[model samples]
Target: MTIAAPTADFLVLPPRPDSTADLLAASARQRGMAVELLSGPVLPDRLRHATGAHLRGGPVFAGAVAEDLDLVLLEPDDDWLTRLPYEYTHRDITLTTLGEARWSRTPMFVKPPRDKSLTACVYADGSRLPGDADHPADTPVLVSEIVTFLVEYRLFVLDGTVHAASRYATHGRLDPAPLDACPHRAAVLDFAAGLLDTCGDSLPSAVVVDVGLASDADRGTEHWAVVEANMAWFSTSYAADPDRVLDVVLRAAGPRDRLAVRDRAFVRPHAAVG
Candidate 1:
């Protein structure tokens, strides 16, 4: 049922090759909902024909992707996203400014909220950040309070609904176990629902959220907390229901009218601000 290129909606993708990207594109074509693939993160031809896209990792693709869908990408410092879990979940999660933490002498899990260019890792201290890990000191990074969990799952959220989920890690290790037998499935879904309901207007039309369960806690009273939120365009689908995830990816990466507000907020180019 794939639509002919002339009449199909366009999905802008990066110039890179990835199986996940291919699968998503194939899924859309099969459904008669999409057509020719456009490579972007840049302005594309026939912008009006674009239905969705998985743009490159650099520029925030608001206008570059399309000019109709009001898609806004989230980063680490997003107040709307920060407030969702802070106010709703019992999980001990909080967001902190990277600049304020620069002088500190404690190791913290530092990551750029949405951009992978900045690199996310445990820094022994702001002063100890590697030379190659170049980003402005004022960058608002998510310095999470380290909490160990037994398992972690990523969910595709659209308009405050959990559409698909997959298990990606366990016990501080990358575990690709299937979610079909995950005992925490019910709890994770329930936790996502609770947080989504409290989203108000902050939740994007599409997004991804990671949830973790602390098995180190007391018996029968384990806890569920949000690991973080990611832009769906670049997020790994892992093992969630692909069809369901496809629904979210289309909207999450689709063209939007919002004036693209982007920055080299992290390890900027060695030439410009190096």
Candidate 2:
């Protein structure tokens, strides 16, 4: 049986008129997709009459928006630490269930497995978490070995290929790394390819993965590693090709039940979730 291609009815409410969200909508229209203009920053309630609405950093997968369009907001999983490669091998990073982390005694870098519901920082002591005041005492978090990264890049992946990439930071700061003339671009791409290959069919079909390169004097090489993954919807499109990125962002952020209903999961706040 021949299946017909689904019509993409994109709803765009850019943070600003000329923002990245607007760029995405423009690209979609150029591709012959139907766009529903929200006029301005409106509430999710307005989505009641719409279908396939796209919002940047839109919360949760339920409610009026969920009823009209199957919204899917992609975030990291608890086992995300195990999904990639090299844990405690060259870098000391581990995932602990909320129930088990309370037993730790060492000072560690504590962060949520997915969203930033709680601030990510080096807690002087693990037994007493800073997020205790804000997050649930039992929410799962990534306890990582803190390392200084020389460069950080965000890659938008679709299928198995990286559609758009941008270097967003350097030396733990907000300096933009130029993709056009980066000296380490080749090495970075190669390392990222290795990590993506490791993920194979494990990762979401459309998602954003952040990778970083740290200097290792002993190995005389720039060690590349997975920093984290983010929802394509909420992530910033640094210097990447906007049109290509919007393509993946649409897949990663739109109504979930539309096409790939199996991957749909609500973004909730356990201790304030994604």
Candidate 3:
């Protein structure tokens, strides 16, 4: 069955919208959808009664709104990278509790599995891992061996196909560019296609996948590898076509009741578990 287009009549944005949010709001207005920018922390009743709506923002705000609006937020599994084949991941990755990860004695790239509660970066050692003052010790986290990415691109996928793409970074810095205009465009698309063809079913139909040309210090070579998967609604459009990105975002977070049975497991829970 084909993915159904969202029936949303309103597009929601957080207070003090960012450039990306402004771009999306413009795109939504162009599509004849009403846009609502929250004035404060409170969600207005008009939005609560809207027939249909889609939101774009950080996970914390999205989670709060999802509970009241009954929106479905789709995100990759906590162990998504660890479960991938070595050919795609190109490095060792482990999914474990923050407490367990703290036992490591070597440098590793450690990050929260699905949230930004903890800063994602290379920790000197397990001793460098932060204490569980803000988050619980059992929170899921992904720890991977360090690898240098020469260039990184973001693909907005819809129904297992790349709907739009943009080169989001180069050498760990923000350098947004249209993928179609970049020399590595073809290579990026090719790699994304192979990855999707191999394990697209493991992801939500509408999601964001980052791929990059990574440098192997030991082998003195460069190759494409999957960076990570993210919820389309929470991903920036960069130089990608905002219209196309919106199409994916709409499907990624819409009415929970319209969600496909297969994607139920991918939904972000309305409430956080302590």
Candidate 4:
């Protein structure tokens, strides 16, 4: 059943909006779209029962709201990163259940593949992993060899192209700058272009792909490698253009029926219903 697009575009925001969401809402309004800043986490009756609603927020709120609404939440597959070429990842990585990760003997960066259910950081050993009582042992997690990134940039991609980019961090610190003004813009965009040309099909039409220059001590050279992919709706705009970021978010979380057939596979599992 295909649902027609509403003549008026509507964007739903959480009650306590963050800087990024506020910027997106402002952009949406500038485009003449309706903005509904919620009174709480709960969606108002008007939107709760309406069709063709678009939203932007954290994963928890999006997940909860998606359960009853026919929303399209785009996200890469849980194992999408592990499946990428070694050239792009530049680190040994594996996708396994938490129970399996509990047996790790060496330090590794571990995190839930698509959610913040687990803290994402390097752990000394498997003993540090939460017990079965906390989260299910079967929960999927990504374990990777630790690598240091000198500088990190986030690319807002749409239709296999880098729509906008910004330097969000440097040496593990928050140091943001618009890509256009950054010295590394050309290299960052070029590296990202190569990556997308090879593996763009693995992601949704709209997404956030982080990349960084990693120190390879053994090779005595620094090179770029992918950091991770995130749902556009839940990602920060940083110094990227708000209008461009809003364009991606709107499509990333718009009505399910409007989703292109090619992107059907990239829809978040929780949003599979609609």
Candidate 5:
């Protein structure tokens, strides 16, 4: 039996040169695939013809598209997209002085909530915090519990299958290696599965799950905890096998005649962010 190729439509920001969305769209076209490129804001006119979207615009624009589209791809699953369990994020709040984060227990990390493309400030116990919030550019600061980890892993799931999985350095540095032999492999997979279960059918077409090994000083046993979640389209493969990651992305975009089904309910009417 002959298989039908998947149709892809991308809703991107304007002047899309040297952007992730552009690169993905180009890749799809290079393969002689059916792809449509739409620019500007996400309006009904633009999304009406799209079956899938690679979203890389601002939160306002991306959220709008997500509300109307069946399958929207995103990068860095941040607060603007959705909230994670037990993760408390305070935007617009600057830590003028670090007087020890009560919730963090140990040293903590402070960084931008959105763009994490650069190094973050690490605070050890009793270290003097930055003089003021102004010290770290103007980006909002995020103070998170400092987690001592053995290994870090990234899990990408597409259409219910573990598409790409890899291990990385635990010190917020990117280094890629296949995780088939990692001891915490099963735990990371389970964590990703659980997240998908929670999302149910409302999950995005491409999602990234970050898992890390947390130190258990008392028990002397390691525990796997969720570090972060991101949208697969905007996230770089980092240390992951580029070929594998790219293949998974292309397959999720509707390759091999398989159409990725998504939830119509996931699309909601646009609402302004408070």
Candidate 6:
């Protein structure tokens, strides 16, 4: 039997040129799918016929988009996800003093909670902590216990389905083939599911789950850990198979019948009215 086409209205927003969002749209079009490209900010005109939108930039307007659209794809909701209890080994410091404690037995990594653009600082020892004068901003810092990781994995969950999964090298490069054979696969799915259940409403319909594995020294076994999670729309396919990722978008829409319509106005704020 021939498969029917999907009728879902897809809004593809490429905030910048040569961005991954544009690449995804190109792939979708190749499959005979209809996708509208929003070249600049998501103004009212751009969002008028949009039922689902894939966003690449900041969440400054997510709340507004979410108010009208069925699905607004972006990164996981930072406010909601950060509250969950995870094995985040962190250090506390006052604004006046920059100090580090050898509390974590293992090597640790430091990253900003809010500013993901900042490169993560890996410290083999605690003495390398930056002083208050050198701190980027007052945003909280995370000091995570480092594990001897073997491989990293990126799993894409769309509308409650594990649509795409890919493994990556230590340096964040994508692996072409699926790592279903990897033992860490199950654990990664479990983590993703739990995350979705907790923040389902707030989370974008599509998101990427990042899982890491540590090679155990004594047993020579790999222990799975949740590395981090990012918005699927913004996260680079890295070394992911672009074709496979595009397939997920196609499947989500199914055979087109009636187009989905979102009734609301999305306004892009101006710094000052002319």
- Which candidate wins on lDDT? 4
lDDT (C-alpha, whole model) for all candidates: 0.60, 0.65, 0.85, 0.87, 0.51, 0.50
Q: Write the per-residue lDDT of candidate 6 for residues 100-129, one digit (tens) a residue.
A: 333334456766533353356667665565
Q: Is candidate 2 or candidate 5 better by TM-score?
A: 2
lDDT of 3 at 59: 77
Off by over 4 Å in 5: 1-30, 34-77, 80-106, 117-119, 124-141, 159-161, 170-173, 181-183, 199-203, 239-274
* Model 3 Cα shift for residue 240 (angstroms): 0.9
Of the candidates numbered 4 and 5, which has the greater lDDT value?
Answer: 4
Candidate 4 per-residue lDDT over residues 1-274, each given as its tens digit = 5443345778888778899999999999998888877676565555656776898988767776775567879988889889999999999899999999999899999988777789999999999999857678998899999999999999999999999889999999999999999899999989999999999999999999999999988889999999999889989899999999998999899988899998999888664322
Best-first order by lDDT: 4, 3, 2, 1, 5, 6
lDDT tens string, model 2, 1-274?
A: 5333234565554434446666777787787766555444343454455566654544432222333454555555666765555731257777775446666777777777666566777766666765455666667788877666788888888876788888988887876644656777787678767767877356676788888887776667777788777767767787788888887877766664554644544242223422
Sort the predicted structures by TM-score, highest score first. 3, 4, 2, 1, 6, 5
Candidate 3 RMSD to the correct structure: 4.8
Positional deviation of residue 124's Cα in model 6 after best superposition, in angstroms? 5.6
- Poorest lDDT segment (10 consecutive residues) of candidate 1: 265-274
Candidate 6: give the clashing pairs.
Answer: 5-255, 5-256, 6-255, 6-256, 7-256, 75-231, 174-239
- Tens-digit per-residue lDDT, 1-274, candidate 3: 5433335667788887778788889999998987878776567765665558788888777866776677788888888998888989899998998899889999999988767788988999988887858867897889999989999999999989999999999999999999999999888888888999999999998999999999998989999999988888888899999999899988888877788997888887777611
TM-score of each: 0.75, 0.77, 0.93, 0.93, 0.53, 0.57
Could you tell me which 10 consecutive residues in candidate 5 have the lowest summed lDDT?
87-96
Instruction: For candidate 4, report its TM-score.
Output: 0.93
For 141-189, candidate 5 gives per-residue lDDT tens digits of: 4566555666788777666556778887655666667778677677777
Worst 10 residues of 3 by lDDT: 1-10
Q: Give the TM-score of candidate 5.
A: 0.53
